[model samples]
Target: MIDEHATPDLLELAARYGVSREFVDWRGRLTTVSASTLIAVLRALDVDASTPDAIRSALGDTELAPWRRPLPASIVQRAGDTPWIFVHLPHGAQFRAWAVLEDGSTRDIPQIDNWIDPREVDGVLTGRATIVVPADMPRGWHELFVAITDDGATERIARCPLITVPERLNTAAANDETKRFGIMAQSYQLRSNTSWGIGDTRDLGALASWGARQGASFVLVNPLHAPAPVEPIEPSPYLPTSRRFRDPLVLHLDVIPAVQLLEGPDAERFATLSRRATALNATPTIDRDVVWRAKREGLELLFDYDLKDPVRKRAFGMFCEREGQELVDFATYCALAEEFGADWRAWPQALHDVSGQAVSEFRDTRADRVEFWRWVQWLTEEQLLEVQRSACEAGMSLGIMHDLAVGVHPYGADSWAMPEALARGVSVGAPPDMFNQLGQNWSQPPWRPDRLAELGYKPYRDMLRAALRCGGALRIDHILGLFRLWWIPEGQTPDAGCYVRYDVEAMLGILALEAERAGALVVGEDMGVVPPETRDTLAHFNIDGTSVLWFERGMSDEPLAPEHYRAHALASVTTHDLPPTAGYLKLDHVRLRHELGLLEVALEDEIQRERATIEEVLDTLRARGALASAASSVEEHTLALHRYLASSSARLMGVSLADLAGDTRSVNQPGTHREYPNWCVPLGNGSGERVTLEQVIASEWAVTLLEASRR
Candidate 1:
């Protein structure tokens, strides 16, 4: 029945959709596709009049035909009564309805005829449907599943998952009335007098004791997300192999009881590595690969001893049980990837697909290696918990505030584990904006919104639960992606990308539910071309927005005064991407950008003008008596700016450690990777020396900033 010769060439189709041929071939024929390509092909076939509204409607209706519907606004029931449910459908489509009880039994509800018709309301198609259940339905908990039935077929066209009822809200509000603030740190930066190259948990515990003395609430850390199992590893936290597990490189080897029992040459090797590690802490810049390699070699020596430890073995069992099959699959993938290479596609045919028999055989054959990977995760988790406990014992109101990256690496374990959820042929990126004229291609696979909806957002919910487990609060990077994202086809320029929309209602609902459950506050990084309604939506859910100093400006070419800062936002002088306060004041960032070839002629001139304007604003602050007369030098001016920011009406503030020490280099350079040495700079010592972790916290600048902030 198939005509192989008539089929479109994969490369030609990829060109038509502006995607990579590899992504197309991976999906196996033209039936399945990445969301970006699917949408592009639909437009190519439609030949409709290209109005913005028409394009959006077509994209929403056609590309998402398999997954689109509306559900009831809320489900309500009295205690010890049968739950009553209601739903408002988008159009009058025959639906197969079922109530999934707490016991996992699905009871079908007979459908009624002609529910509701879609009408043009405010220039948009709007439809409604409502269904109420009997008062004597069931007593416990339940959920509703609604599926649109296809003509003459038992199969459903679209399905939506909805909460049937709630028993109670279990999370309690914080009893303390004190405001909280947190700092993000690198584990290697926390050094002790006995530390081997970088800071360890012992140093972190010491810092926690110091933070308590200063009345600080918490200390956030960079993604402790596990790095690759291989050597010459990816150092960027944003490009982790597994976001679910903590990196073993940060583990304090001395704390492990089994390490003391080792003997012979293996023990001597451990001693030599320990001494080298201690020396590494005194060095500038974290050598992640070297640190991890040392830790791994030391860990391998203790592997046999760890297997005999009953308590450790039990802990490992508990961890495996808690994580379920996903953890095993991730670790298995990591071990195999290291042996093969980072890319899964390049692996042997049998091992290529994680769900196949070849992977199962491999797992059975390499059970010890699998268990070793699991043990590493368990130890990492244990240490991270210890760090949190230390923070709480130090009188911190919030233990740690973790950051959730926008997306995961394309070739990483997450993508391999859940290929169905990810868009294979597309890369997540930003559209061309004023700051980044060329736009950005992050090379990270985005979640297929439709597939996620079909699966009731189980994967997303799990990710959020894992991220929120150890943190008091979580910062969602690129929070706007929850509503919509710009999906650039693999081989296309960012300008060729189109916006793919998400169900904002469902996304907000899930977020609110998670935050309520965790008893945690949510902060959204709501920067860059945010939709007009985004702020209002965030406000409705009590989510805090981010406000940075450089972007704050009034309508009449006036600088946004300190008083104008929003009450429900985190007001900061600068973010990780921007220049530190000292760098901005001295215009070092401009020169850095030029060196990285990120600055063009027009933008370079514009930056200079902005710098002049900033200086003028600082002068105005001095003239108005807002700033002290001592704020004459650039260093003093930078400090005054921070003081003004701290005194703002915003509920939260973030003071970068880089700014405290006048560190000129940025943690990340937006445009270039190899051309720029990003995420490698250490906090400066102000004496033209790169400061050690101990020196950073003990600096006069750090002390002054802390004192001023408390006031």
Candidate 2:
């Protein structure tokens, strides 16, 4: 099955290395090789492998020139396909491989030569095949050619254009222009007057408006991504039911036209609910269930009144047309989840398959349910767009950057819609890093990278397009996943997870292309265990990285200066994971971390040290004549941090609204779920009353920070 001319003679190489052909086969299949094995291969090839450093030195000094090849046509494999062909070549060299069809047209294919298997080689010269064609190519005379060109020197090595037409199209070309950012209002305390129960779309719109006014080009909100169908829902935005749809709980039910149509006692009940919603908005803590319930009830009444308004129906039709089968499958998953208690596995066998007859019948019989779900998406999109409009009107440059979660819930709508895309038996998470030694199992299903690639990365491309549609930018949570992800097998601890690689070239390329089309910028969440190369790669693409204040300490044991910050980074004093500025100053952050078992050292000592450091920095500012107008109070100090961030060399700066209002609690506490009230707090005053957007701007501290930064 192997082409002799296109591959290295494995038996010959095996003999040269004094290793059997079987051993070579094993090495090719092994994902990770030991240092000894690596050394043996190097030594067998007459290369230095005495020590690890020696091996590196020898390879670095080789000075071998790169091999070049001609462009190849795109080839894709799908389910039930056989004989996958891979062209191998050296890394850091430009080679093109294109297929010549019957019409004499050429199509480009992806090239990767950094690593190759000796036994299964197809496209190689000397020890490698320059190109390989699948054995399943049609029984016709075809010519496949591989040209090696380096520094303008061209050499034709092999030629084959006889491959059969694959079932799918390959669309893995990389684009380098998309920028992303994140928003965190849900963590902020809610003000009562404008929000319903917690901070709803109205507040989100106002925040977007504020962001735009601050000269931000775009504002990225957390996954407005929908959650599971069942009650007592997971509050984490990362664990979403459907990445394609928005959460209904965030709907501004009061703004809907049907609310005005309520009559008599119905109107009174609606008024009472509105009043309660307004009251709840004043509360410090966000009651998600309560808000969801209120909104659901209100929506039910609205749905009953105007089940199919012309505009709403048209909007639904548009969504259906835009999303196509993906939306249909997602809505079906939601309906099925609702009936089967959120677990598709627990549902009847007929409903298990999205394309099954049961689903088709359900769609026909329960058309209203499907239409209602679609309507919810339409309204959600409308509200988000309105937020964007408000931001643009407010004179913000970028405005409304949205956050894209890393993965979808295991049993959520996305998994149901694209079961083949997700690894049903494994989950996505982080390996043990400096921050969390125990590691983290996010409990969200990850896409099967191989499957996604085979399908030409349609799912990923669609997602990026959707996210960039409404926002000026997008913040990819765990942005490293675009390159590699730690995959934990089912029933295993997170520590048992192993790093699975991804097509970084395709990922970044698609992102850049989409962002260029959408006129947006990209920001990667490169916090925690980010490799140095990741930063370098992101910088190469003009994608901004994140810089948080607490983590900006230098190796020299000195604080990082604002001027030292990279211009291609988004600088902020704190993030949703850290304590708000006010809470940090009050030492509440120290106590909270201690209580949550996150603190390893003495809490008092840590707090005192941190406080001293802050004071020392303030003193430095005073000495430099930069603190003369700085605020003296804790709230004022918080404002000063914003001013510092704003004045930093970084191109963009983010001010958490929680800090603006002096809210103490963090929006999320990483490890603990039930133990900590993560994602439950609203933006509000210390007394638990939800603060309105006006209140936030009116606050003396907010005004002080905003004005000080201007000076």
Candidate 3:
């Protein structure tokens, strides 16, 4: 039932706009969205529904809005399924339209639908024309152009974006339909001999090379999305200032081209800084701020150095040209953040608008600083491209699978850049579940669904394009967000939140288009309390789902049989949210939960429940003949669990680097910020010894694990 305050017209308008009035909650009970929440969310969408009369007016505006535009901003058609676009024209108007292909070719499109009676829209007599796309139209982001004639004269020209999407994505591996396996590790924690205290793109390149040699098909990594470039640097890769850029901290100073140009004293100082970083590498914790500070000082010298190689300079200039205004906007934010603070909302009013007169004046004064920031982005892009290029050269099918975080930080560049497109009063979050009764508020702003559609989903498309440009595969952090998101109003607890629906068809279609274009695989993290139809819908889009060994159980006490696992899923023994396989066997998660006071039940009860769960896993592994050793050491348990994962029918298998090293610690534990050192832990083996990538690559243990993975 709709809320009492919402009239029939208001409810209809909300439904038409994809706003949910009620939904089944986590408890499987009918939950109604509060009236205040709906009104606030509507207002955030720029829908004027403040009163019943305003609701009627908004509905009228919505109906006539399409007529105001010559054509919708975007049109999506399936690869082989023909679809028509409705065109609005003044009465007695004639138009000839055609689609411009990516290769600069054009295909003429014809109007298929019969004429319709002219209707008055905003005092204009608008008639409808249906343009039908050919069934065999190639899939791509094409442009549509129309020459219009009205009042016996042809003068007006209209253009719009035409997106042809594949009904389902088929990755390169899917062509052969053979099962593939890869290694999953936190990119930041993967230390190497050449790294500057923390892992860098060079380390990623080394790991990819070694993993390919070990028969791995891909190297999945944590989100490398850039954090704020300042002291008090962010540690978690998941919380990035801008998902579109890479942090300069991940650059290997020795490998940068400009570093070669450093003269006598500068070269010596750079080496000194590099050696200083070496001292921090041996520690068990990764201090991102310290690492960034050291790298920043060295990079600043390179930033000031003039270029001698015209070839490299031209390439950098082309990159800047290709990136266009987005790069400029991001660089401007970075330059301003350096002067102001990380939170753009806290900046002075004169510097608040990124494109305003005041900001332009600031840009003129700080042109050098802005250029320096853009140069940093170009440098990262160079390194990232090389890392992926190395992986593919090393013969991996899907090289350097990048992780995409669910959302950007609340006060970061993205939020400040697109204030109107992002919801302000509500933050992305989750409802109260059995594991977390208090619920969760991620503090990341949710995208305004209405605004996203109005913009023809350019923001989402641009993000996917950036993510896939340098990688063979992309792992969407929280894939469920495409369907719906739990939005918690600001200044309120998550319990008061409600689920807001999204335009999933449009979203998924665009994802398919981008994936097809880049020849990249897409894996969605569709774990943890998913809706019943989610897996099915994802399968329809050919987006692979994740299957963790720990949670792959049916209604009974036994684990789900390996053969019963979904064929389209990526089977893995553990994920970043859990303790590494070895630590999971040791029940380290339970202890950590208890330490964080995250356990709601009595500690003993929790332990007992975990005991039963672990027993079930061991029993199933033994029954399936997956266990090789009689002794129940951490390494043996991890290998056995991985063997079970390999036995699955799932197309992709992911083995953790930590599991191979026999590490018993978690890289990240949910529900804790600074409480448990979430994303800053170093990679350690089962023997409780931290190991660098060089050690791990050559270790016999990794070879043994790779054998199991291949089996």
Regions of candidate 1 where Cα sits further than 4 Å from its true position:
1-98, 101-160, 164-179, 186-200, 282-284, 602-604
RMSD of each: 8.4, 11.5, 2.5
- Model 1: number of backbone collisions: 13
lDDT of 3 by residue, 322-371 (tens): 98888888888888888898998889987777778988888789998888
* Per-model TM-score on C-alpha atoms: 0.81, 0.74, 0.94
1-711 per-residue lDDT for model 1 (tens digits): 222221233223333433332221111322333334434533333322134455445444543342233453224343234433434333445565777776888777544443455665445455555555545445334566677543445645333454332232223322232334445565555555566555666667666667667766666566667667776677667677766666677788888778878889878998998888777765667677777778888888888787688987888788899999988998798778768877777888788688999999888988888888888888777777787778878887676667777787788788888887877777788765555656778777777765676566777877877777776777788888898776776688865565566666656657666666787767788988676598888876677789887777776757677778777776677777776777677676677767666654655696777688787778657776668867567667767776777677777766666666667666776766667656655556444466656676677777677556652
Give the Cα-based TM-score of candidate 2 against the true structure.
0.74
On TM-score, the candidate that comes out on top is: 3
lDDT of 3: 0.83
lDDT of model 3 at position 523:
90
lDDT of each: 0.66, 0.63, 0.83
Model 3 stretches with alpha carbons more than 4 Å out: 1-10, 115-117, 304-306, 555-557, 628-631, 686-689
- What TM-score number comes out for model 3? 0.94
